[model samples]
Target: MTRRLLLSYLGLALLVLAGLEIPLGWIYARGETARFSQSVERDASMLAEVTEENIEEGKTAELPAVIGEYAAESGGRVIVVDRKGIVLADSGAGSAAGPATRPGTDLSREPDIAAALRNQTTVTTRTCTEGGEVLSATLPGSSGTTVRGALRLTYPMTTVTDRVHRVWLALALAGACVLAAVALVAFTLARWITRPLRTLERATTQLAAGHLANPPDATTGPPELRSLATSFTRTATRLQHLLKAQHAFAAEASHQLKTPLTALRLRLENFEPYLDPRAHASLDETIEEVERLGRMVQGLLALARLENTATTPEPVDLDAVVAERVAMWEPLAAEQYVALAVTGVPAGQVWAIPGALEQIIDNLLANALRVSPPGSTLTLARAPGTELHVIDQGPGMSPADRERAFDRFWRASDSHHDGTGLGLPIVRHLTHASGGEITLHAAPGGGLTARVRLRPAGPPPRRLARRPHTAAPSHGSTSATVPGERAGG
Candidate 1:
């Protein structure tokens, strides 16, 4: 933008200079040429008057001497011609006496000389056979109203052209100096205009990066830019306040609800022993619903905490985290008669917030297990490109459900699990917050697949110990399998 502004200013300056300098230069050259022609005509008229006097006195012998002296002084050639179109006195070599005694070429046919013989003074410009151009002025020599001869003076045009060229050269130099100064001023003005915009750009970048604690200064530059900067600072302050209020509300609501939920759970536990055997099933169902609500509240609190705190991602062992989560959830899978398996590449590392990976794995595993049929396998796999996939052999969702899967409190109409619907939304938020992506798709064979792609953090530290791939056995049963060592299933 700065470069564009500078070019625009320089272009305008050049246009102005061209408009002003071109016509003035042409006029100067024309005036100089006209002045030179006038001077030559005046000299020719004076010489013609002197020759007329000599012709009336019949002292034509002194004509050559007079003409030669004038020619030498004025740097021009002179000639005297009678009405008969014959040169009588010539300012040429061997004319030491007078050309009247040894006449030269006829001048009656020459245009300017012919006009002069008719008593009319004429000045004209024409090329010379010898070389350069010449300006010729002819004046009639009259002896008391009778034209006797003509005086023709010729001056080289080179002197006039040289003078015009010098004037043009000086103008060119002056124009260049003015243009240089204009360019310098234009550049300074452009920088002045863009400096504030550059500062605003840097401030905008910082704001986008969540560094709104220090707003940009609004006191510099023109009034428009200053006003814009002030507006941005105010808007950023208002946004900061709004976010703080939202986070405060979420944290307060979650904390406030926890006490009553705990009290209710305690009351339900106390009343469970007094219920009859037939009613015990209903009590257990109520307890489960209460537990689900408690988990939903906890998820909300965790999400609120994540939103309020800006946590930078760090290196984490994807395989190690997955293996640990699988072991923890293995007992529940076994109780449901679902085979829990670990598969895909081993020892992969990714960058994620400290506890985000664990929460995501736990939620996905819980969701998968809840829908898996007995004897069906639930695979916890690490795919290429720093991705993790939880595949379950259960009923999958339609495309419409997958599209809104990340929306908070959204659930499929035919969903079999009793979930609060916050699990997937939390997973999505955490994934994005860590600069990753989460997606749901239908597994290859059957059921749903939850895929999480994360940013890789290179290899794990060498000091970190590798854990053996094994799931905790439930009730002494060993139905789960760790396939080929390379396949890791």
Candidate 2:
């Protein structure tokens, strides 16, 4: 923008200079030529009067000495023609002349000389071998309207042309100076206009990174940019406050809800011993429901925390995480008569929010394990790129259910399990925060395949060593995932 502004200023200045300088130069050149011609005419008129007096006094042969002094002083050639159209004298008379026509030469046929004999005074320029470019002024040598002879004077055009050249050179130098001044002023103006915008740009990048570290100054730049900076600062401040409030609510609400649900479960368990045999089942069911509600509350808070925080992605080894998770869930799968297996080529490092990959894998594995039938295979697979696939030999969701699965608390209509339906949404939030996406496709066999796409973390970091690592939602499940794929606040 600054460059463009400078160019525009230079372009306008050039146009102005061309408009003024071109005409001024041309007029100056023409005026110089006219002035030179007039000066030549004045000199020629005085000499013509002298020629008339000499011819009347029969002293024509002495014309050379009389005109020689004037010709030497003025740096020009002179010619005196008789009434019969013959040359009486030439300026180059008795010396080694430089290409000038000598004495007794006929200059009567020359255009200016012929016009002079016709009693006319005239000035014209012509090119000639002897004089290069010639400016000639001629007038009649007349006494009482009877022409005695004619006098013609010629000067080289370089005398006037050199002055015109100097004037054009001066104009060129002046124009250059003006353009330089415009460039300096334009540069200053452009920088002034764009300084605030650059500051605003940096401020916006900081805001996107979860907080605005340094706000832009609204006191500089144009009024429009200043107003924009002020508005952006205000908006970023409000958003920060809103995020802080949300985190506070998530923490407070999780604590507030967990205590009462635990007390209620204890009260229901107490009632179990006093109640009859038939009431035992009812008390147990009530206790289980209360526990499920508690898990739902936890899932909700986890999601709230995920939404409220800004997490930058870091490199995590996908293969290592998958192997570890499968090992941890293997015992659980075995007890349920299902096989927990890891397959597919090793995907190297991938970028994910620090704790997010572990949480996502936990939720998906927990969900897949719950839905897998007895003796079915549950696979934690890593594709060649930055994808993790959890294939479960469970009842897969329909197309419509899959599309809406990521919605908060959205369970399939035919879902019979006790899930609160927050698992998939949480997984999606974690994936997006890590700069990736999640999609559900039908499993290759007769199950569901949850395909988790992630950003490649490039090469693994040089400083880290292999590290060992480490929860979930509803159905009273200790882990984050529940049977009905439920989640909470």
Most accurate candidate by lDDT: 2
Residue-level lDDT tens digits of model 2 in 19-127: 9999999999999999999999999999989988999899998999888888888888888888766888778632222466666777777777788788888888887
lDDT of 1 by residue, 237-341 (tens): 888788789879988998798889989989999998798989988988898888767766765676676666665666889888888778877887889999889
Top-scoring candidate (TM-score):
2
Off by over 4 Å in 2: 1-27, 43-114, 121-165, 222-228, 273-289, 307-311, 335-344, 372-381, 392-403, 441-449, 458-489
| Clash pairs for candidate 1 | 88-100, 483-489
In model 2, what is the error at residue 37, expressed in angstroms?
A: 3.7
Q: Given candidate 2, what's the lDDT at residue 131?
A: 42
